[model samples]
Target: GHHNVQRLSTVYTSMGMSNADRGAPLWKEKRDTWASVCDDCHSPRFARENLQAMDEACKDAGMKYTETFKVAENLMLHGMGEPMPKDLAPDWSGQHIWS
Candidate 1:
């Protein structure tokens, strides 16, 4: 059984945690904290390898999201999305209908 929930940096990021600083991102500090927790039950080398794998996975996902946002923005700019919320009528539930 593997347990590493305490080191889920992505969850912290999603919750709007500040990893930014005046000079550079605080990624190293966060990584150190994660490694410290992970090292409690695992060897330092094992913890480091797992953390590096997680970092690469997060980097790849961020790149994919950047590309996806660009495509969505381009489509919206070209008027590909028809009947936007502003043009929709409010339904009985007081919410704008997508139809």
Candidate 2:
């Protein structure tokens, strides 16, 4: 799920979209797309509410991730964390013990 979210965020950023753009217009687009296929069996209100709940869950998860990452980042930045493998590069993309 993190991979999927990262991929989507990359696409959105490449399209010149900001995080703030994830509001009614984006939500309505996703809702309408799903509704076109699912509205036959599900009430629009039900689908909308479910999507809204999922959005809230995602927002909460993102906040938690930010908080956790900040702690790890601070530990590394201040040289309080475990040393990285000598063979590995300093970039985030490289394979590491945590990955």
Candidate 3:
């Protein structure tokens, strides 16, 4: 079917993506970000050991190690892949916290 073909091709393309080409280095980059947010929002320090342990736990539970994180749609839609927007400022006041 069309869906299976699409999924297969997606898997192939994903397999071909180089480490640098991926938006974020999943385990290192995103997990660190999560650790920072967690420590800030909860108890004490964000230990490297804990993060590594958590990563190990996730892997044991059939989680992925690395993958592409490219925001393709938003990149195309919001002119990120096109010309830069004028006067780009951080609008923290906006109620819609999509970012």
Candidate 4:
């Protein structure tokens, strides 16, 4: 599932291993390993296509999340939502968020 993709994206990006990191080879290696596993049960082309579809789905999910976060941010900014608890606020300077 793409459930962990968002979190992994952040982690890998921070570690300079994300797919978006221009010179990184780790991301491609990991992707190839994943595709090989999928190929065990499906044709290589089918596995590749499915992986591409999943990537697209994750991209869509990320866009939706950004839109949702914008709404939440607006609500907070306009005083329409409850204030975030101090302990749960995102620490942007520290690049972390607490529950």
- lDDT of candidate 3 over 18-96, digit per residue (tens): 2232224543554444445456445435445665564455444322213212454467677877633656633333412
| Regions more than 4 Å wrong, model 1 | 1-25, 83-99
Write candidate 1's Cα lDDT for 1-99 as tens digits.
Answer: 245665563533531212223123545666666677767678989978986775566556556656776787788889995544754532343321211
Whose lDDT is higher: candidate 2's or candidate 3's?
2
Model 2 / residue 30 / CA error / Å: 2.6
RMSD of 2: 7.8
TM-score per prediction, in order, is 0.55, 0.56, 0.27, 0.56
Residue pairs clashing, model 1: none
* Model 4, position 97: C-alpha lDDT score: 28
Question: lDDT of all the models against the reference?
Answer: 0.55, 0.53, 0.40, 0.56
> Best candidate per lDDT, number?
4
Tell me which of candidates 1 and 2 scores higher on lDDT.
Answer: 1
Candidate 3 lDDT score relative to the true structure: 0.40
Model 2 ranges off by over 4 Å: 1-21, 83-99
- Looking at model 4, the pairs that clash are none
Clash counts for all predictions: 0, 0, 0, 0
Give candidate 3 misplaced runs (Cα > 4 Å): 1-24, 41-45, 63-99
